[model samples]
Target: MRIVFLLCSFLSLFFASELITPLPLHINYDKSKAILGKKLFFDPVLSKDNTISCAHCHNLQEGGDDGLEVSVGIDGKLGSINAPTVLNSVYNIAQFWDGRAKNLQAQAIEPIHNPVEMGIEDTKALLKKLKNNGYEKLFFEVYTDGLSLKNLVDAIAEFEKALITPNSRFDRYLKGESILSQEELSGYELFKSIGCISCHNGILLGGNFYQKVGIYEPYYADENLGRFSVTKLEEDKYYFKVPTLRNISKTAPYLHHGKVTSLKDTIQIMAYHQLGRELETLERDLIYKFLLTLDGDIPEILNEK
Candidate 1:
């Protein structure tokens, strides 16, 4: 009877809609690279002021973002877009809301040189400075050639690759752990039944593709061009890459513009604009609970400084 029950459980897992991602979980990331990356991530040498680092925006302890609606850059200038979490970003098909970057390696250099963000005009000059500084020794220990612009990017990218937050309750359930509470199970069902899975389907849970922010209604009262700004294609207008829901409970002021503060409000907006369905108060709460399950523990190193 126990063997029969196990077989039935296995079959049920196969039939579950949640386990649909094409990518398998990757283990065994490089610790030395991650350590180098972490230092570079926190070091303000990457910024113009030597005050801002990647941690300024993608703060790990604060749900991988600094909890601002829009991020403040160097000289306290506020950016127009909301900062997304750095966690589980390794799973994303592309980086940035408009899919501007092909990988973490390419994504690493943009902010360092962005006049708004880091304010560094020349990456070579920055690397020369870093090479003469303390991280140079560490880089020499880690890499054969030491701290070049390419190696700096490589270290940061390596650290980002190690930022995966695995073993969520959903992942455990997928691995046949049978651990989700009744409310969580119901919430997961509702997540699927309401077609949230249509876009949010993946290991990263929504980073796999792009979708229009408002399909049914015009979302733009103020004309934020979204993907059109990147592509200059009419079809790409208002089409932003679907953000991963991993650590969703932490990474809010939600949405692209950071207009919505509450998850309940964000859900209502998404339901109305994207789904054409009005979520009841209780249903909204349930979906929120399921989203909370996506909040896994943060990496210990991120919290230290």
Candidate 2:
């Protein structure tokens, strides 16, 4: 019995090392471009009515999401999907819930053009507004070509690249710099042994790949077809890019549909629908405690004046 326990422990450690990694303390980004992008991200002039900005949906101050079931856009228009957290978004394999946009640069300009979101009707008009609103000089400071739509999104992407949150308690524990509580440790062990680590592995812990929402049971289908909208493939239906679990505690109103607000309920739902298991109340509680360790320090870039 003791030998069996030691072998299990050894295998667990091996899988943990192969499956998960600690986030880096810092990543490279063009600071000047990111600073300019920060300004543009908060500026409402990008909208047609000049009332909405990127920050309106992605509130960097908390959770990197707006805390809405679905985002409210320009002129009180409601979006179809929940806003994914911008925190550590740089690590995602692709952007948006649908994976429609290829990268952050592609993702940055999308809401500006979406009718219900930023609602910019004319690219030329937006350029004029930016030039008149002192953005031309800012663009010149960062880019030799001055202001343009390409550069605009490029700068925003650069800023998003710097939005990685590092040094979470889990990450410190992974690095052997800190230790988890007994409950947290047990919860993490369950996380790996129970197959959560199969999909939710990697630095950001679940952003690395796409997965179908319901495997064991049927999750209710909605108008949003997920990646099927992007690829037009039958197999792609209901397959969305698995979101990062980093800061899962802060970004409430979980999932692509944003139907579940309680993290415990979300856990139960995932267990039943995805894992085909019904967790006891105590198991859910311990998993919740483990998840809390994922909340990390805010990006230092947000602190820049």
Best by the lDDT measure: 2
User: TM-scores, in order shown?
Assistant: 0.89, 0.94
lDDT (C-alpha, whole model) for all candidates: 0.80, 0.88
- What residue pairs are clashing in model 1? none
For model 2, how does the per-residue alpha-carbon lDDT over 1-305 read when each residue is reduced to its tens digit? 33553454456556766788988999988999999999999999999899999999999988999999999999899999999999898888999888888899999888999999999889998999999999999999999999999999999999999898889999999989657899998788778766677668889888888877886787874678788998999988888998889999999999998888999999898888877899999998888899999988999899885
Residues 202-294, candidate 1: write the lDDT tens digits: 787788888888775668834577778888999899889999888788887889888788988998888888777899998998888888877
Residue-level error in angstroms, candidate 2, position 129: 0.3
Please identify model 2 stretches exceeding 4 Å from their true place: 1-14
The TM-score between candidate 1 and the true structure equals 0.89
lDDT of 1: 0.80
Model 1 alpha-carbon miss at residue 144, Å:
2.2
Error of 2 at 101 (Å): 0.7
